[model samples]
Target: MKIAVVAANGKVARKVITEAIKRGHDVTAFGRHKENNTDASKYVIKDILDLKKEDLEGFDVVVDAFGTWASEAMHLHTVTSQHLADLLEHTNTRLLIVGGAGSLYTNKEHTETVASGPDFPHDWLPVANAMADSLNALRKRNDVHWTYLSPAANFVADGEATGKYAFAGEELTLNKNNESTISYADYASAMLDVIENGQHDKERISVYAD
Candidate 1:
């Protein structure tokens, strides 16, 4: 597969690039900052908003790992998602987004999203809520083939791959210890699985530690 990863400098995007290359797929990495090293065959140093559809041509899938915690949180999330959807519309390329866990429901009844829960970090709420709104925007799209992958609640940069994971619908998934978490490596694995298998189309899929 020929894959284009947006925000290539990010932690999760880097992991996804590594995992995708390990699987023998061709990768084109795009980011605001240029890095000295990457396994991606091609690199585009540009802002996601400035990227044109012609720049994204010929890839089998485009992974929108674009995210921001700045004051324009909602604007960045919504604009980037909408831009990608418009760029990929009526094209064969699929849009796979690396989303947040905030949109995942916190309990079994599925009435409350994690962002609506009391424990959701106050500082991170802007970005989280913005991402949830982005998911809502994707859900309403009919022209683009998209998949939004929301990681576990405790998504972090520091854990081993374990090469294992489990899934849930709109709710936060937890392990036997009731911890909702997943390694960045395993999150990359799950995203690649969705990309390669085309299992969850036009929907939000959550992954967490098993």
Candidate 2:
């Protein structure tokens, strides 16, 4: 499949692009910076916000892996989501967005993980809240096939791609030790699984270690 990965410079995006290439998929990597590597030449240096509808004309699947760093403001996520939605409106392709954990819930009416957690950083709240709003807006659109993949509350950089994880909708999943966590590699794997398998369209699903 031909895949277009936005924010190809990101850690998760880089891993996903590498895996996609290793799996023999033709990937169009879009990002702001061009790295120094063989795959770096394959990247198209462009800002997502500046992308026109024609810019995304020929991709099979579009992955919104572009993310704002912890130090950056949340407006970036909101703008990216809006731009992605606009781009999707012009294509027949499927969109797989990488969303934050703030939208996931441990209960029906509460969002304890990131929205109201004591450990949740106060500075990152605006961005998290913006992403949550973006997800909500995307859910209302029926013209495009979009899926939101929210990682666990504690998605650390450690661990390998075990390829063994649990999925949940709206509600958060807990591991044996009663914790929520996942590795970036496994998260990328799961995203690709959904892309290849064509599952969970027009839905938001959360993944975590089990």
Candidate 3:
């Protein structure tokens, strides 16, 4: 399958791109930076807000991994979500978003996420919450095939690429120790699985260690 990954320069995106290529899928990587070294040669250097429909033509899947948190939290989320929605609507392509863990709940009655709790970094709340809102907006659209993937609650910079994890829909998953965590590699693998198999369409799902 042919896949286009936006924000391909990001750490998480890089992993997805690499794995996609290794799995023998054709990939077109897009990013804002011209200096970044992405293995895919057919790279488009453009801002997400300025991306045109022609730029996204002929792709089986488009992964939206683009994000910014410098501006007002709500504005950033709204702008990013709008761009993604436009691409899906205009180009008529399926979308897979690298989402936040904040939208997942331990159960239906829970109002807060592990990321929004007192233990999470205060500076990260805006971005996390904004991503949750973005996912919410995407779910309301019935014309698009979309999946929002939330990583485990304690996702960190580095961990073993075990490629072993469990998935949960709407409800957050907990391990034997009652913790939610997954390596970036595993997260990327899970995203690709969604892209290839079209699982959990129009819904938000979470991945974590078992």
Candidate 4:
């Protein structure tokens, strides 16, 4: 498969790009920063917001790993989502987004979301809300093929990658130990699985440690 990963400088995205290449997929990385000794066949160093439709033509999928912690720049999450959606509208390529857990439902009835939970970090509200807004926007678009993959509540940057994972629906997923957790590496592997299977299109999926 031919894949393009945006924001490849990020921790999670770097892992995705590397794993895709290991699997012998044609991979191109797009990001603002230059990377040394990257495994991707091509690296396009440009601000993601500046990417035009012409620049992203002819790919199987575009994995959007765009994220930000800056409070004033949080709105860019939705902005970037809209831009990419518009660019990829009705195209052959699918848009796979790296999403947040804050928007995942906490109850079977779907009355509340993880953001409403008391344990959610206050400092994370900006980015969480921004990501939720982008997801909500995607839910309304029928022109683009898209998928939003949300990590567990305890998403770890450098957690152990046991090479195992499990999937869940809209509700926040917890394991037999009653914990919501996933490693960045595991998430990357699961993401590629999703891409390869050609399932879960136009839906939001969750992943947690198995």
Candidate 5:
């Protein structure tokens, strides 16, 4: 499959690009700052917001890996997402967002989210809200085919890829150790697997290590 990853310079996005290339997929990196994945089929240095419809043509999937750690710019998540969705609306191409765990439901009833739960960290609320808002915006639109993959509560960066993972719908998941966590590599693998499986459509799924 042909894949394009926005904000491909991010730690998580870099892993996604590398894993996609390693899995024999044609991968392209689009971002403004850096080109860390030399293995990509092409690297385009452009702000995701500035990406026109022509820039997104001919890709089976566009992965929204855009992220911001600063509190002030968190709204960029929604802005960039809307931009991509607007461009790809009613097209055959799928837009898969690199989502956040905060929006994942904490209960089977789907009333609560991770960020709303008591144990969630206080400092992570800003970005979590941003992520949730982005997903919410996508939900209100039916024009584009999109999937949101939320990593487990503990999104490990330097952890190993066990080549094993499990999936769930909306609800947060915890592994055998009773921990909600997954390494960046395994999360990337799970996402690519979702892309290859062609199962999810306009849905949000959570991934955790096995």
Candidate 6:
């Protein structure tokens, strides 16, 4: 499969690209900044909103790994997503968003999101809200085949892949120890699994440690 990753320089996006490349897929990396070193099969230096339809054509899947911690840049999550949807409308390319855990349901009853609960950290609220907004924007679109993959509540970096994970939809998942966590490597593995298997379409799915 031909894959394009937006914000390809990101920590998670880099891992996703690496995983895709390891799977023998043709991968193209898109980033807003110029990088001196990259391992992508192809690279594009352009803002997500600046991308034209021609820029994204021929890819089997487009991963929206675009993310920001700055409060001002948070809006990029939603706006860029809208642009991607418009650009890919009526095309066969699928849009898979690297989503957030904030909006995920904290309970099986779906009464509350992690972001709405008292446990959510106030410092990261802006980014979480932006992710929620991005998901909402994607949910409203009908012309594009979109899937949102939210990470575990305790998603972390540099942990072992183990090539194992548990999947869920909307609701937050917990391990046997009642904790929600997944390493970046395993998260990338799950993303590639979804991409290759085509198991999810027009839905939001999440994963955590098994």
> For each candidate, what TM-score against the reference?
0.95, 0.89, 0.91, 0.97, 0.96, 0.97
Each candidate structure's count of clashing pairs: 0, 1, 0, 0, 0, 0
* Candidate 4 per-residue C-alpha lDDT over 1-210 given as tens digits, one digit per residue, 9 for 90 to 100: 989999888889988998888888999999898763456768999888899998889999999999999988988999998899999999878999999999999998988999988988898888889999999999999999999999999999988778878999999978989999999989999899899988888999999998
Ranking by lDDT: 6, 5, 4, 1, 2, 3
Record all residue pairs in model 4 with backbone atoms less than 3 Å apart, i.e. clashing: none
- Expressed as tens digits, the lDDT of each residue in 79-124 for candidate 3 is 6656767767844478888888876775568776666567778888
Kindly report which residue stretches of model 6 are placed more than 4 angstroms away from their true locations once superposed: none
lDDT digits (tens) for residues 1-210 of candidate 2: 999888887888877787788778898888876662325346777889888788888888999986775545666776787788878884678989988898787576764646767777887677678788788888888878889999998787767989888887787778898998999888888788888988898999998987
TM-score of 4: 0.97
For model 5, the stretches where C-alpha displacement exceeds 4 angstroms are 34-38
The residue ranges of model 4 lying beyond 4 angstroms of the native Cα positions read none
What is the C-alpha local distance difference test score of candidate 4? Answer: 0.90
Error of 3 at 65 (Å): 0.7
Residue 122 in candidate 5 has what lDDT? 91
Instruction: Give one digit per residue, the lDDT tens place, for model 5 in 1-210.
Output: 989999888888888888888889998899887655545768998999899999989999999998887988999999999999999998999999999999888888999989999988999999999999999999998999999999998999999989889998889888889989899999999989999998789999899988
RMSD of each: 1.4, 2.2, 1.9, 1.1, 1.2, 1.1
With candidate 3 superimposed using the best TM-score fit, by how many Å does residue 137's alpha carbon deviate from the native? 1.3
Q: How much lDDT does each candidate structure score? A: 0.89, 0.81, 0.80, 0.90, 0.91, 0.91
TM-score of 5: 0.96
Query: Which whole-number lDDT from 0 to 100 does residue 139 have in model 4?
Result: 95
Error of 6 at 162 (Å): 1.4
Candidate 6: tens digits of C-alpha lDDT, residues 105-164: 987788899999997899988999999999998888889999999999998988988987
Q: How far out, in Å, is residue 133 in model 2?
A: 2.1
